[model samples]
Target: MLTCVTRGLFIQLVFDCRRLRKMQPQQPGYSSSRAYLELIADLPWQKVSEERELDLRAAKESLDRDHYGLTKVKQRIIEYLAVRKLKPDARGPVLCFVGPPGVGKTSLATSIAKALNRKFIRISLGGVKDEADIRGHRRTYIGSMPGRLIDGLKRVSVNNPVMLLDEIDKTGSDVRGDPASALLEVLDPEQNKTFNDHYLNVPFDLSKVVFVATANRMQPIPPALLDRMEVIELPGYTPEEKLKIAMKHLLPRVLEQHGLSSAYLQIPEAVVKLIIERYTREAGVRNLERNLAALARAAAVKVAELDSTLRLGKEMQPITTTLLDSRLADGGEVEMEVIPMGQDISNTYENPSPMIVDEAMLEKVLGPPRFDDREAADRVSSPGVSVGLVWTSFGGEVQFVEATAMAGKGDLHLTGQLGDVIKESAQLALTWVRARSADLNLSPTSDINILESRDIHIHFPAGAVPKDGPSAGVTLVTSLVSLFSNRKVRADTAMTGEMTLRGLVLPVGGVKDKVLAAHRYGIKRVILPERNLKDLAEIPAPILAGIEILLVKRIEEVLGHAFENGFPLRLHSSL
Candidate 1:
């Protein structure tokens, strides 16, 4: 009975194809029908890539060779491979790499494909708003076609290729439809086994294909879609890590691309350090890589000029004494012979001396340093200016909050593209300060009310950019305290934490990123909530060694470290 049913379905498909083929070119459905048949024929229904035998050791080595210092991420990849090796048919969770740009997420995906010995395909979903992008447009549509997944498979000519959904989080919902919603079926293991596309109108098995995804952030991705994949957090690289990557991976690649070698262009480790610090302030080595590439390009041009000079000089050598001398003596033109290919150009002018990159060369090629370590110190020089650490999409940043007092109704004025939570935090900071004005000794005279006498205005610099989050709570209080007491917060110190009206400091998120940001800006001291001490364990030892981390249970402890003189708040009540 099953055989009869299968035969009937096969005969019906063949009959439909024949009828479509016999249709005339002027027929209403000829073009669409032809396209539909072409798509069906082109899809890799039975064709699959022959995967290599999995070797955990080799895979690890390949990952290390291509990327530098992602120990945990590499471990996760290895574990996934090991499972596949033990049971080739095992259903494993999809890997979703979440990190800032240029952290090698896409490259890591490529490396995985190489390790698995499968064809690789990348489907960019950066701005895909239409659901038809993930699931094909219906055949009833005039210009319908297969979705990105099926089309990618057809292009790679394999069903089991490693497919990367690049920039998955960038997909958004609209009147057309949500690409992310369509992706739900594509990424889910149970459902994806029989994934359906509207144009194909047939179930395709995606179980054999290895799917990997990359995103700049996790929050933008829908929770249902995010839950299907194993999330791996790739944090920003430290200066040391970037340095090693520049030397080991980026430098060699850049030199090769620009047609130069180390002998032609020598970039010392110290110069690379300067490039990392002075020119580029980023969470990833992307901009650093660009700077290095620029240096290489400059060196390439110089090398080419030197080569030309040597060639001309070498070609002239054979005629310098005889032909050119006689010609010049007679006031006649002299022509130099061209050096033929395969000649010993090595004998030509001793391989024009290598150009070593120095401070001057950096300034010449990349222009003046874009960032300075002294920015924090210079900004926090006056009272009411306090350095606060905040994490943004780009990673951690040192935000300087400035507060000043003016004679007006005692309302708080906030600026710098602040959000509601931060605005509330500012209000909370003001109320707390006013409530404890006696202990803080806000005014020299006891009879006068500071709140009634002055209005406070606070501004976060970089007004063009948006800033928010409750982590600024502690920093807001510090800025207000500095304003009322006329004392300057220590220029070398930065703090991040939430605060309560009761003056207790609460822990916040992104502790590691914040500390890294402080270190990036040359801050020697960092004040974090005492509860966030455990987060310090995740920070690299070298970073911690350079900066002093002070933990505070109360906001007063932050004030103690933030100022040269401890803020002595004498409590008068035992509530």
Candidate 2:
């Protein structure tokens, strides 16, 4: 019991109720505020830290030693972290790696975790549907767990941890805002400072957490959510890079895991390359790792099964091409007589050659190339069809641009899921061609005139897939010019650039991807805007060694060179 409101200077010193602790009712029927305060005090309060690193030097070393060939990707990562170091106030950059699966999105995330001393958590959202998956449920829901972001923090017991949100683009919107939208608060550097946890009932600063997101596509991302994050594209590994990664990391790990350790488990670089090119088709090493796992398991089982059949030796030996070839025909028709791999063998009794593999073995194992060397040439050549080199996260590919002018009502039609940017690009190309038609020795018919008299439609193939980006300008214009002028651009050449109505060609991005696409398509020559020549510095010397790169400032220069027969490009009034 306490008396609180009393005159103090009147020499009436009474018990100060404000200074007295609230007493828990000792009576039989007791209900008190003390019970509620006890519950609140007992609630778990976790201590957290925002910026923690494992070991920056070690992370860099691990990346260099673990993977091969993606020098650009590793370099980009360093630059990203460097920016973070420069601005410690900013949370670690939100990285969105756009690339084909298996190139090492998940692996690199782990490496980054180990490099930094902070805890690391990886969550896959490939098919996540519930917004509650990201934003925690209200405490009213029974047995509801905290959303991924909060749970990650509590488990790590730190404010800052590397939380890899895999496949953020796949995060969908439903009755509740998309899980991606929930990321708005957590990922936003401004609002995350007061990130309130429903259960904790206290605002916890979350700006310290480092968030990284990965996806195979960028188009699906909501603009509002995407604006808050930094996107880092992880490029696919080249064949050489794949082979080296296998030899350096995958093969040894598989062999050790399968109990075929030591030098005896050696897989030759050539065979590893063969496995990568034939058995796997991805930007990353996941496929190659799985294939290697299969091979290692198979080798272990084979050796175990063959133990009593043949005399054993104390020393383990590497499985040569001979043994690998023999295993390929293990349960097949070639069982009757072993096919020898190496050249030259003779015996008096028509000795069957022992099963061994060489270049010729590519056919038996992979069942002929999925594609042929002359596949490009085998395609039927059409009047306005032209090959365009375009780059994707999967590296580069040769894209075909087919222009067809059909007999229809006077109208301009375009199809093939072209995005706004690309659609605008096609229109620009058309305007450029119409203005310079006379110079290329073709009728200069504007779209308005053409629609009034004749109908024309242009399309980029592969309709099921959405296509955008503005690097297709030159391809469209060249195809149209070739069709009207009745000429053919070199079958082995590809071009990519943006064109203007005034006939002045402007530079576009994806120069490296375009060049790579050309190389992949067996094109000997490529045409890019002269301005993009600076981007060529990113190109590896080995990849671009034999290819011819032609930089053009004007569409007219491309006209004479791209077409088979040289025609003086008509000087447009604007030109």
Candidate 3:
């Protein structure tokens, strides 16, 4: 059955199909025309999932039930639901969850659908480079179908289901066209009311559909497309958060999925802590969850083997037959009978013991610890090496900058898949250090520049992985200072900031992620630009409590905080 709008279109098409009487079923365009008609008939023009009354308390409970932590994100979701409850017809801004993988971005969108009692559909836009993927190819093209939106509506048989455009940042532009541009109309509240698809050849009413999107980063999303949505940033989980999630959500769920119970497979809290610290180093609990699942699988295999052995033993149990003398005496007939020993049978079977996950077991199943916190201390033990923090798509990571000097034409060499911004920052750091060589007491003689007689080479390890950004500015300078002074920076300290040619430090982005990275690496102290103190408020108090944060406004202060012995300036200097 078609709605009024579609019914009218169907009638018009029927009138135009009089030529079909002259054409055979095997004629050109016959199948496509027939498929188009079937699609029109099948589409849910007005059908909708009967939305249940919005219960804010129940919605909050649902969100909390499925996810742990994410207090800010949960609050934002509650507010969005509240707005929907207050004005059901209001055109609310599309919510776009931006976060690293395994941070529950997709699951939260699913929860919203459950809360609203709306049918849920996920349209994965990752690696979708063609515009046809969004708007559909024109009907003139053979084998064309409707866009993802229309096709999804047909699938759910609803005009107002909660639709998730997942991985929105992964879309790209090419000669075919930009899918992001096509999404502009679909996401825009004012324009989506009449969403047009090329194959459909008619505008579909998408105003009732509730759209939610997710992305790993916001930079790739078009500004115009991004403007139509409200972005909620979900940061990576702390160790404490990951532990709670593992114990409360991941473990039980994994065990049940593997057809085993905690009684059959036990993972102690200490073992889990070890997994978090040694086995995996990540911003999210995805790896942790996978490890837990692996343990569960191993335990399941053992349990299954035990069960099969018990079943084989039962099948092989010997039975002793005896003559029925009572029957022979009473009825004058003899019969052979097997005597059943109920109590004895119970004694022959024993319940299988649960498999416990321990450190040794972890090593066996997960191999040696993939990451070590002590690595930072060992790497920074020598002079000309310092730690810096930078953010990546996976989350924040600890970056080590190593600098050395050798005899050459005083040219600077930089390695490690660095970008232009970082290369420039390195040059700026070098220039700043060279200008302050005399004040820093680094000149061999009063008139000799530090780099005049030797070339400098700076290398960031993890050379295969691309590294960039200005946050490593101070780290580079500190490394150079350590190289010249032959004094090591504190192994326990890591710093991030942008430096100027005048020996001033500037604030940078991803301060929270950097701090988290430091925490993950067991770095006790972090040197951050003074301007980023406000950003620290977003970090959990527990994480901040464990690590000491030093805020600095200038490169001098950064150097002072970075080294165990203060970076002193000479009384007299060459200006």
Candidate 4:
């Protein structure tokens, strides 16, 4: 049976064909109407059926073969495929892969397409500010065309293609409209069955299409749009996983591209590890692949040079018997005649000297390491400085909070592009410190007088990068206490938690990311809110093993764990 849309389009095409037949051959409307009729005829009205069964085993193998270290993402895709196999007509939820760049989010989507035996289409939503770019411009406008969704279907000539909306978080909005808001109707499975494009002027069935979106961060995505999709997180790779990926996938491909074999150019395990640790630091192998390609190009040049030298007839002379005897005899005892014994060096060109990329070679090729944790460690080694862990869009990072006091009017200065929440946190921390100065051993005389006579300044480094959130509450308080009492915080310690007015440590989000950040910075100890202890389960065991995790319910407990000594003797006695 013909659907309403098909019935209407057929009727319209019949009328247009009759009108075009009557019109003159060279008339503009005649040719245009004929073309429109052909387009309407070619529209794919019927849904294509997958004759082959959904193969879970083959799908798993394909995903594993294409990508590495996205175990949870692969599992989720497999589960979806399994459910899909059981119920063919079920509409799957839209999957959004969230991670930093080069972590295989885009490639994973392609792998999904291959697994399901569907055509893949990619539409980058980055910098797409106009809503028309998504829903498409109306027919009333000049040069109007179908939206990306409809266009993708037309190009693939199928209804069940895997459509990837890459960089969804980067979609922009202005006076035109919100492109992200336009995606709400398209992403929601219930509404997408009759997905309407403005130019198409007909309801297109998008229920069968598998929509996957990728983003570096989730915060920029509209909440309504975010709610429609199931998010799968792909965190940064571990050193071991990175090395494996390089050896398994990247090395051979790079070798083949450079026209060199692994025998002629070898990258040892230690060298690959050095490349990962020093040359590039990212959650994915994009940069790692680039580094490997560079190494391959360098090796290719050496091979080319060796081949050129051999072709130029530059052969080494073999040592004569007289020369060997002269070398064996005493320095001034024998005289030897030097003669050229021609030995073709061309054979050596067949097996070029293997290029071994070590730590020193990596330095020469990729320049110095991008990050240095030692400088950060030394900066936070003194009193009035404390380390705070933060979660950013790129990934987790360690931020240093520094506080200093001087004799002046009782004014507190806050710098470092701190957000309002963080500024409020700093103020609250200062108030808490002032109120408890007597117990904290921060005041030699009256607490009020000590605070009133001094000016306190708190600053977070990296002044250009905006810092926010309530998570820095404990770190700020510790910095204040250390500044006032002349006690240094533990150099290897880091803390993250919100502070209440009554000295309670409140829970903060991103515990796993913050802990990972701390671990990356070589922090030996971490103080977190007791409520976030469950988040520790999400972190890997190896990362957790290196750090001492102290779950604290109150600010005093944080102080005890953060400082080198459990607090000052006087404060300890008072407690």
Computed on alpha carbons, the lDDT of every model, listed in order, comes to 0.87, 0.67, 0.89, 0.82
Ranking by TM-score: 3, 1, 4, 2
Clash totals for all models, in order? 0, 14, 0, 0
Off by over 4 Å in 4: 1-6, 13-43, 47-51, 308-348, 406-408, 444-450, 569-575
Off by over 4 Å in 2: 1-44, 47-56, 69-92, 95-100, 127-130, 154-159, 217-227, 254-267, 271-357, 393-395, 444-459, 565-567, 571-575
| Reference-based TM-score of each model | 0.90, 0.73, 0.93, 0.86
C-alpha lDDT (0 to 100) for residue 23 of candidate 4? 95
Candidate 3, clashing residue pairs? none
Question: The CA-based lDDT of model 1 is what?
Answer: 0.87
Model 1: colliding residue pairs: none
| Candidate 4 lDDT tens digits, 1-575 | 14636777668657768898899988755655564455455556675636368889999998889888677789999998898889878888899999877778998889878877778899999999999988877766756666787777777777788899999999999999999999999988888888778866667788888899999888889889999999998777666778899999999999998899977788998898877766665656788999999889888988888788886655557646976666678565555676556866445557655788877877787788875658556887778999898877666778899999888899999999988999999999988887777777766633355577789999999898988888999999999988877888888889899999778999987776677667656688999899998888877788888889999998989999887768852444332
TM-score of 4: 0.86
Q: Name the best candidate (by lDDT).
A: 3
lDDT of candidate 3?
0.89
Clashes of 3: 0
Q: Which 10-residue window of candidate 4 scores lowest in summed lDDT?
A: 566-575
Comparing 3 and 4 on TM-score, the stronger one: 3
lDDT of 4 at 556: 88
